[model samples]
Target chain A: MQFVLKSVLISLVLVGAAFADGIKPEALSKDGAVTRDRHLTEIRDIMRGGRGGYIDFGFYYTPSREQLPLESQYGEHDGFAFNHHFAGFGAGEVARGRHMGALLWFDRSGWDGEDFFLFPHYNDFSLQRSVVTWGLTFTDARMDWTIAAGMQHQNLEHRGKIYPYEVDSLAYSWAHLRFSKLSAQANFYRTDWRLFRFSLDLESRAIYGGKKSGPLTYLPNVSLAMYNADEESDIDSMRITWEQNLYDQRLYAEVAIDLNDTWFHSAALKFYPDPSRMIGFEATCLNRVRMKQLSDDLVEEESDLLWGGAIDLLFARFAYNAAYDYENFFGAKGTFLVEFKFNLATIDGWLFNRGAARSAPMETDVVKQFDKNTKQSEITPMGSGSGAPKTIEAKGIRYEKAQPTATTEGGN
Target chain B: MKGTMKKISVLTVLLACCLTLSGCLTHWFVDSTTRLQIENRSSKTVVEIDILSEEDSDYKVWIRDTIRTGEKSRVYEEDWVGTFTMRVRTVGSDFDIENLKLDGGSEYMVLSDSTDGSLHYEFK
Candidate 1:
């Protein structure tokens, strides 16, 4: 284990050395406010992807659950009230030409209080995932049709306790098929009748030696296959989504059905109060369909409902969620989350462009013209000599008049 | 236009019904990675290094094994973030550094031996 960890550490150093570019010196020249904001924006870009590519960093915590009576046959296991501490980083980028993209994420969840727990019984784990996508976009004057094929590889260092029957570790790879269509009407923002944008995504977990660890197993359906301990692979899922936007508001609906014998439906309404999308709010509801095994011989289908709301402010977001007659694996009811994210690619283009403008020096000609106009405007009159109309031809200049004039030209 | 609006309204209601009728269990959260490098300059070999969170002192983000004297440790990345402090333990002495800033990116620290048997440190 030490050797493996050392190897990973060496790889990280090599990777970091190769991409040693950190914050630009100019950005750090000030009190580092630019550096901080840029970091936040870069993380945001990773989540939503506006700046082509980004390296993301974030932290989240989920409160511990109340103690519950254990009925395991082994012994009375200490269900110590331990909170979940998670930290991870992901980097991804899609080419500007929409031809290819790749993403990688490393996530680690540590049980903070269980410091000295013995391994084999209680172990440490990490997950690394890599995905590559190839896409093609067909666009005409009125609409865009996009199709993509992708593959994702997932590696788990140590299998969690949830999957008890699993061996020491697991690795699997899968394929994805995605298609979408955006009508010209949707882009026009017309109040009149128009077709909603539509998209569909499908994943076949059965491909590429699905769930590679255990013996080869086959199942009948995706739903039932998800829960079968004997059949670890050969599962699939499909999702369909429809979206519509009207000026500052958007409506989205989606349904996903998994071969693991589960289904999910969700709908969301989002409002962008400002044109920049720096501040926005969204209300969403989700419903899940599950195939639960109630007894050794009996199985049943169950449904759960949940609703949530989220608010995004510049570089941060807060969300609150509540489940209806539903309990999580830990029996928690509601969750509150705080996140720092900004997608310079989504709707913060203007803001980031403004930042770019601030960092980038002005052209010499523009600066000279600006200085000349400012110096002359202080002494110049609205109408020079005899109240005739005046035309100031200074580029990039704005004139504020005290009174209305007959005619004005040149200056903007 | 009115008919289209009516259809959309009905579709929206149907979508809501779908959400109200179906379900699963999920919790969404994002975790961050933090990188740190330590250079041990003390004459004594260091045993363990503990990284404690500022918000929750009891929380241990990482417990590193050992750093021999005059040895520089490689950059270590952990699934952790937030403001933190460090405690370095040697044979019979321990050193504590408060308010250590690790900007969620990369940080380097150099620990040196002092004439009076204390530890001096600086961040790079």
Candidate 2:
């Protein structure tokens, strides 16, 4: 057990070191205000990329139930509140990834098991999965888009060593099951709308795979969402989403959906006080219904209203997220997450071309302020309604301008 | 409970506005790409202009563009930040301007006026 723990930690460190490239772009000389904006913009870009292609470790505990009803007869269990899990996951881009990113990942989980046992041989290590994806991104200052294709292979089983029910049985016979799927997906981010701090996205995904040999099967889905930019506070943002899938169309439809076809509708309200600075709250209503169900036990569907608030903080390359989620079926649970991210593109100056380049920290802005005080030319932001004193500094020149209202560019 | 219903109602109205507000007028925000707006107020037709980034050749053709007399052109808005040089060619003569620095979020314009040998630079 100790060897496994040490091996996993060493593997994560080695993988990060192998993939990380060190090449920070030299900062160009710009007067203060512009450099500050550039720094802020760079921070936003790094935050947007979030976490991908990195090692992920997680632990989940639900003191409710863990076994299937049929397993009660085996009579080896004790209490109802016994759900516990620990998992490790790692993935990253391979060399010929091109502008299109290709990633391979592996994850394994041990359920209701202790991380350490009386001896290394007695520890349980069962659930396993491998997922591979290739994705391409298209970027415009206004709209960012991505397309990806993926395949997932999963294996689930029990060793049966303790019960000795199948010492002669084939490998993975206790609860052996293998699942695989191929999927193609496209995502369009909030890049389109320009009015009232907006975010509008449209997406679609097509999937196939499952059963061993028969006619090919496919499951297709589409989704759309519209909301305001997250920067606003009060009753400033609202989101509406609708997504649908005719699960009945798949070759193994019965295996995927119990009711018949499946569909989901959701609406949410997000409020924050200049959330860029502090905390925020959200309220959501979600309804998922299944079609063509033969029995109630075959389907588990719900229409729920949930509310949660999150407190988020950011410092340099690290951040923390804490939130509580509650619904009638799932009860209430609190989650705390911490992440540190590194972006190779930022270090290489790909983020700089977006008009915000960071070469100096806040100190440079102060120095530039002194330069402005000494200069005879007075800089004033035009049409500046929000009193942001807002202007962009270009080269050695500082100019101020009022922000324009967000608008769509063309005719419908 | 009443307060919650009221909040939901208001949110629903706002959502309706966000959805229906589309297919109207369009607007866009400017980013940090370098921008050059040039006006050929000079009496002689400005045949061509070339931009060169002194540090690297990452931007090659950004230096080669043509502008006609009395025509205003937007030139070389890209993601590279650096010190650049611009050369102007006319029917009879050429002018070389050194140390033309450019970066994102910066807007610059040059007007070529034959009336004066001095060059005009504008900034925002």
Candidate 3:
């Protein structure tokens, strides 16, 4: 056994040296220009550096609506509701060339009083939701591999003004291989928790054909997760989801089922006109039956089906999104979101241009001309004398140019 | 039983010797044949170096003068790894190679970053 171990160590050193020798010293440059293929560079850039932090604020408003049939006599008055959300995201690479980075994210959202009252009286309390997430990612360009591990905390308002928090830990990794006319990717993800649930998911993708024709397609994905309230309790159940994309890039569908004394079926469809715009609709039906452990006698329960739709639009420097969701047991809820984004450096350039225009000095030129027909005093004809005022044409001129335009330099 | 044990021990010793020889031979061939070529074409002066380790760590870099031709000399030395950058600026017309070197086992070379011509280096 010792001999085998020694041999393995020696082999590792040899392989390391071989790889090191492959590094072309001449290829090093300080200009930050990597002499790799376009696709490879794209992947490398995504994993290379990390961003500091970002502040995001969002507002959503949904009008009151109702669910019909089962609760025929129930009607909720039309009311306006709003939510404000704030988040900060940051990440950094700790190890050199190993492609390792850590990410931290925090988000908080609150609902307005008017929106809170739209629900049942017992549920009429202001809501505050917050989440904190931390993750570490490992990336390798040569091997085309990336791995990430993280944990998250989610808090929601409960029972009037009380807040309850749920914690979850997750680990995920993805590997992508490139070929001449095709590519494949494998992804593994797992999340474990006590308050919420624990789940494991594995996904694979084989992409063939070109961007336009060969059918940009996908198939159902599989996942197995356990849900329970607490330890030592037999209230555990398994949940599964299957999804697929069809009809070029125009449609997407998914179905989910849980096997814990409850039957749930869900279907969704997405319509995408182009790369930047999409509309989607989804519905879910759920029925809960009494389990032997909970109650010896089986009883039939009411079935609930919920439906919703959403629209998303991506613009040059802004995005617009709207969604409407309705649950049979609750009232209808909707959200409208608008986001405006611009690079900090670009804004600085705009401010500088404005300042330059205000600080510029204005000057005008006046020219005296001699026209023989319009001269008030005796004037020489063309080429008749040398001392006469040179014939000149008066033209208006501005000393300053207009504000600096957005020059198309260094554009992607 | 005693005879069989003796025979097995002898065979094992012989096999170990043969495997060791083969491993050394493979390492020799790999090291001798591995070569990396770099072409520098930039306006700034650049020092090219290789990080020859699987471990992610910094390599020292510097310059030292090895050969002198008239007023010119070749410099080779190890440079500080943290302060080192891929590109460096040249002050005069002459390319002073003796002023830069890398302190470790890795191979490195300095060249003018111009597109007019190509610079080549051979490692043995």
Compare the candidates by DockQ and give the number of the best one. 1
TM-score of each: 0.36, 0.27, 0.35
Candidates 1 and 2 compared by TM-score, better number: 1
Docking class of 1: incorrect
Superposed model 2: Cα runs more than 4 Å off: A1-110, A115-267, A271-281, A284-412, B1-124
- lDDT tens digits by residue: candidate 2, B1-124: 9999999999999656433332111112323245666676666666666654333332234434456667777665543333456666667776666765554344655555644775454553
lDDT for position B97 in model 1:
70
The positional error of residue A372 in candidate 2, measured at the CA in angstroms, is 9.7
TM-score of chain B of each: 0.60, 0.51, 0.30
Per-residue lDDT of B1-124 in model 3, one digit per residue for the tens?
9999999999999656434421223223222111222333334343334322222243222332222211222333221211112222233332322222222233433243344543222332
lDDT of each: 0.37, 0.30, 0.31
Per-residue CA lDDT of candidate 2, range A1-412, in tens?
9999999966754553333221111100111112122222222232222113222222222211111000111111111111111112122333222222333223222222211111111112111111122222221212222223233232323432222222121111000011111112211112322112111111121111133222222222221222222334323222222222222221110111112233323343433333121232334443433233457667555444333333322211111111121211012222222221112222121121111112213465587799978765656547645666767677767677856545445455
Better of 1 and 3 by lDDT: 1
Q: Give the per-residue lDDT digits (tens) of candidate 3, residues A223-293.
A: 44343433454445655655455654445555667774454645556555532122223333333232233
Which candidate wins on lDDT? 1
